[model samples]
Target: MKVTNVHTRRIHQPKEKVSKLFKTLATTNDLIWPYENWPAIKFLEGLNVGSKGGHGSIRYTIIEFNEDDYIKFQFSRPEGFMGTHEFKIEALNENQTEIRHEINIQTTFETSLLWIFVIRWLHDALIEDAFNKVENYFTEAKKKATYNFWVKLLREIYKRKPLQTKIA
Candidate 1:
């Protein structure tokens, strides 16, 4: 099975301001990873091609890096996940920019089942929080992520599990 998802966020900030973020995009991008109370994404090495990193139970290696524009990571986890995911920045106008995060993967039957029943649910919530974080970056009033009932319940459940056992 092939699974592809693209999630985006448009910021009021200009591309130049957003581009400045690319340099630290893979390393300390706390703006997108829900670092305060959630699992934070981190690269074990430089945020460039060949760097290794992961968050929670996920593992990936940077495969492509285009400074100020794009970065791609090859996933190597979830038992049968095979593919790449990327983050891209596009200038929409003189004072606006957009952030796009996409995942493209080929999965085995078992993995497809996991995606349908488990991963998909968490992935959506994760991305939504990421979008909200970006919005909060520019606004004076803080923005909070609102998860659905299931998302809330599942996250609580995940929090109770052993750190080494869950992909959350």
Candidate 2:
């Protein structure tokens, strides 16, 4: 199966300020990834083109890293995820920006089932949490994320597996 998935958030901050996120992505001090509660997203040799990284049980390689604008990671694990997932920033105005997280993948039969039944649920929840953090940073507003029962359940499962605590 070939799939394209995207998640986006509107941030009420200057695009210049928002763009700083790209500089520390997948690093120990990242502001976007909620690594304190979830698995770290780390680039084994720093975040640059051709670097490698992962979160939880998924692994990927950085194929593109365009400063302040976009980054793309091609999946390398949980087999059959052939394609890249990327984060893109689009300036909406002087005081607002749009952040889009997207993934395009062609999967094998077994991996398709994994995506349909498992990975999608976890992925959505994780990104929701990520966006909430970003919103908090710019708006100083408290955002609440309500997960479906399955996402909540999957979180418990994923939390059991320990990965490095590199990204914040």
Candidate 3:
């Protein structure tokens, strides 16, 4: 099965400021990834081309990196995931920028089932929460992403028997 997923958020901030957030990714000062509530993204050699890391059961290597513009990661774990995911920053205007997270991959039959029943719900919620975190950082008003019933339930289950969030 071919899966293509994209999530984006527009922030009312300068492109430079928005772009700076990319540098903090997977770091102690990360302000984008909703790591406080979910699994934190970590890399063995930090954020750079060839650095390997991922959150939860997902593992990937940084295939490309551009400090203030883009980052792409190619998946290597979770069995049947085959392809890449990337984050892009686009300037819409002098003071507005968009952050986009895109995933493109082909999945095996078994992984398709996992994606349809479990990972899809969790992944969507996770991205939304991450976007909310990014948006909240620049605005006085906070943004929050709510989870659907399935995501809430699945998160509870995982908390009991946590997946291998660390890459080997």
Candidate 4:
């Protein structure tokens, strides 16, 4: 397995908003790349759902999803190998949330020499870029959402806050 690129971003949004964003990413395929319905099953041709499509569900077949605080997935291509991607969310403050994305690639290359070469070349070049793109997408989305939320909040506060009292 090789560790590619990892990106972390802090979004200035409430915990609830952050959770909603995460949930949107987790449950909605429209927000993700290679856009396709039933992505998990479509990508993993012969896989079966180990449990119901909810928290702690184990995907035994080609693709799998498990929701334990964070939503994680494991997928395998035609090659006899698999990769795992996980997203974690942490509440930083009343108006900030932290998101971390981790990706691991495991291939069937048996020889250490081949593994090292692939890790150094393919991983650094292709896999890292792919993960970075995904991270950038989420980061941009979160930023936009956070900005909108704060703007609206400020507007509401400005409209509601009483005018400053004049000193005698």
Candidate 5:
């Protein structure tokens, strides 16, 4: 089964700032901790790291990575099935970046079928919600003092109205 989605937004921070955020978000340990805290995070406890970071082996697994571009990893779950998650990042502008996440499930017929059902359920109920949480984090980060210039400009743009004009 294949699941893919793309979400894009204009961030107030420069590409460097956004890149740092993406790097933090993409790291295995960083990503894992949030999951560790949430109830859903516990679902993939035993899945070894396989390969981590850029071209590094993780949990004895071989994963692919493109420096500062993307990362992909594959692992088997407790149910004896394989799955993969890929993350891609792109710079849209000096002050904006795009992040994309893709998920794939590979397994035997019986296991795949079971996972298909569960994955769909989780995608609809939990994964989507998790992505929203990530989006919120980006939004909040853009509002910080470091991003004051962009935020102030945006606020000014919002306050100006073409409809406000003097009538004779």
Candidate 6:
């Protein structure tokens, strides 16, 4: 099955400032990923091409990285996820910017079932939470994204399992 997914948000801040926050992705000082509410993205060799890491049971390797533009990761785990997912910073204006997360992949039957039944809902919630984290950074009033019923149920079920904390 071929899948194409995208999530984007416009921030009322300059691209430069938003890009600075993106630079902290997967880092100790990460300012974008909603690690407090979800699994944190980790890279053994940091944010550069060839670095390997991922959140939860999914895994990937960085295929491209541009400090002020975007970072793309090619999936290598959760068998049958063939392709890439990336986060891009687009300047909409001198004082506004858009943060986009896109996924393009072809999944095998098993993975397709997983994606449709579980991953899709979880992925949507995760991305929205990440966007909220970014938007929360530049405003006095913070934004929070709520998970849907399916997402809440999925999270509850997944919480019963032990989480992986280190990347190998």
**TM-score of every model?**
0.89, 0.91, 0.98, 0.43, 0.50, 0.97
List the pairs of residues colliding in candidate 2.
28-166
lDDT of each: 0.79, 0.83, 0.91, 0.42, 0.44, 0.93
Clashing pairs in 1: none
Which residues of candidate 3, in runs, are more than 4 Å off? Answer: none
Q: Across residues 54-128, which tens digit of lDDT does each residue of candidate 4 receive?
A: 111122231343332365555333243456656666778888767666656665646334446432333233223
Which prediction has the highest lDDT against the true structure?
Answer: 6
The TM-score-based order of candidates, best leading, equals: 3, 6, 2, 1, 5, 4
* Candidate 6 residue 47 C-alpha distance from true site, Å: 0.7
Q: What is the lDDT of residue 165 in candidate 2?
A: 44
lDDT of 2 by residue, 30-137 (tens): 989977666768777887888877887688888988888998888888778898899999899998999999989999999999999888988887888888877887
Task: Write model 3 residue lDDT over 105-161, tens digit each, in one string.
Answer: 999999999999999899999999988988898888988877778999999999999
Cα RMSD to native, each candidate?
2.6, 2.6, 0.8, 18.8, 17.3, 0.9
Q: Residue 131 deviation, candidate 6, in Å?
A: 0.2
Q: Write the per-residue lDDT of candidate 1 for residues 64-162, one digit (tens) a residue.
A: 988789889999886799999988999999988999989999999999997887778788888777767777877898777777887777778888883
In model 6, what lDDT does residue 168 have?
65
Worst 10 residues of 5 by lDDT: 52-61
Model 4 bad stretches (over 4 Å): 26-68, 78-80, 109-168
Residue 130 of model 3 has an lDDT of 87
* Candidate 1 regions with alpha-carbon error over 4 angstroms: 26-29, 165-168
Candidates 2 and 4 compared: the better one by lDDT is 2
User: Over the stretch 32-64, how does candidate 6's per-residue lDDT look in tens digits?
Assistant: 999998988999999989999999888999999
Query: Which whole-number lDDT from 0 to 100 does residue 115 have in model 2?
Result: 96
